[model samples]
Target: MKVIVFDTKPYDRKYLDKENERYGFEIKYIEGKLTPDTAKLAAGYDVVCAFVNDDIGAATIDVLVDVGVRAIAMRCAGYNNVDIRHAFGKIHVVRVPKYSPFAVAEHAIALLMTLNRRIHRAYLRTRDGNFNLNGLLGFDMHGKIVGVVGTGQIGRCFIDICRGFGMQVLAYDPYPNPNAGIEYVSIDELLSRSDVVSLHCPLTAETHHLIDAKRLSLMKPNAVIVNTSRGALIDSAALIEALKDGAIGGAALDVYEEEAQYFFEDHSNDVIKDDQLTRLLSFNNVLVTSHQAFFTHEALEKIAEVTFENIANLSAFRGNRETYLANEVCYQCEKFGGDCPKKNHKNCF
Candidate 1:
């Protein structure tokens, strides 16, 4: 099958090319993100491979359909960028729902520990041969309470890591897992009682801006907040105000709401246009990374493997019109007064 991969990076090319050796599919890599302007690039391809930041909205979907693109293979778990409701009958969408959860979970802990212990500051100081220990006092994590906002694979992995540090774990999820081995509490209770609040939830109507002004106010003044999930899950403006007002002690973000415009690109010579992001960079207490928590080697391999498998599975049933080969976009089939083709409703991995 012929596939066009968008939003290509060096590591993406390396892993995908290595994995494609087995599938032997005709793959074309493009450095640009998928958008209306670039949608025509997939004209002759059988499938379009996209990443987390690519825009697969209505307009792009229309263009792809007109150009004979049969399927979409998302390399990431989140599909918030794609408007599945619009691409209902025209196309099929498949995604890697679970890559390496440990990659993101470990990165979240790394961010929290670095922020709390002032490792970044100490690295800069000791490099200049100045070894003063003032202002570097950090509390022990042994007796601390870490409130996990989601109990999914990534959240559960993070909980296990926190337990390794002897931290008390409290989790909050609408569909709580009884086997998570942590106390399940209300979001309000988790916010008020946690010494460290970590967000691992997805971005959706109910979860967007989950941590807003009121929720920020509910957190302990000395508590630390870390987010390795979707950026829009927290209100950036509210977070800025909280940081400036010292409402929360610190924040470590590997993602941002407005990251699509800037992240994964180098802008060292340009001025930052977003005032909220600019202000966020001025705070020493806040740590910001370029949405790379899921960029580990293992995660990249799994993403490529699952994405290829999704395409293979769909390609295998191209002649069978009765199969729900659209993957998770089957929900949109109801709009056309037709039953979804797939019998099982499980998420595609």
Candidate 2:
């Protein structure tokens, strides 16, 4: 199949190219993201491969459908960018579901470890040859309560890691997985009891701004929050307020709510306009990464593999004629995967 890949990067090409021969696909890589204006580039291609940041809204989808683009293969896990309801009968949408959950789960823990151990500060100081260890003290993670929101594969893997450190795992998922030794609880209880709270939920109506001003207040004074899931899951403005007021101890974020325009790009020379993000960056306890939890070698390979498989499935007649093949973890294209939400229907589906 002939595929036009948008939002191409050096690593994306290097990794995805390794499996192209097996899939019988020739991908035309475009460096820039596929905006509505640029959606015309998908003409004559049978499929379009998109990244998380690429805007595949109504306009873009209309353009792709007009150009005879039959299917969309999302290289990442989330499909919030796509308007799935509109594309249901017109085009098929598929994604890479659970591509190396260990990669993301481990990165969440890595950010937490880096923040708590003062390793970020220590590295900066030693680079200038300060050699000061006076304020480099850090506490241990043993016997602490870690609240994990969303008991998906990544959350379960994170719980396993925390359990290895002798930490108690408190999880909050509408549908709880009982195999991980995680005790499911309410949001208030998880916030009040946890020494560390980690977020692993997808972005939906119910989960959007799940951690708001009121929820922030419920957390302990010394509690730490880590989010490697969707950015909108936590309210950034409320989080900044909590951090400024010392309501929470620390925050380690690999994803931010307004990261689409800036995360994967190099805008270091330009002045960043997001005031809340700027203010959050000023704090020493807050650590931010560019949504890179799924950048591991294993994850990249799996992403390419699953994405191609999704394309293959859509090309074949295995799925229904109205809609294309939907990824198993794709809540956007499909219904809520296995009844996690209290509601019967998915928001965008």
Model 2, 6-40: lDDT tens digits are: 99899999888987768878789999998888889
User: For each candidate, what is the lDDT?
Assistant: 0.89, 0.86
C-alpha root-mean-square deviation, candidate 2: 3.4
lDDT: worst 10-residue window of model 1:
340-349
Looking at model 1, the pairs that clash are: 324-341, 324-342
Q: Model 2 segments beyond 4 Å from truth? A: 318-349
Given candidate 1, what's the lDDT at residue 73? 90
Q: Which candidate tops lDDT?
A: 1
TM-score quality measure for candidate 1: 0.94
Q: State the lDDT at 171 in candidate 1.
A: 92
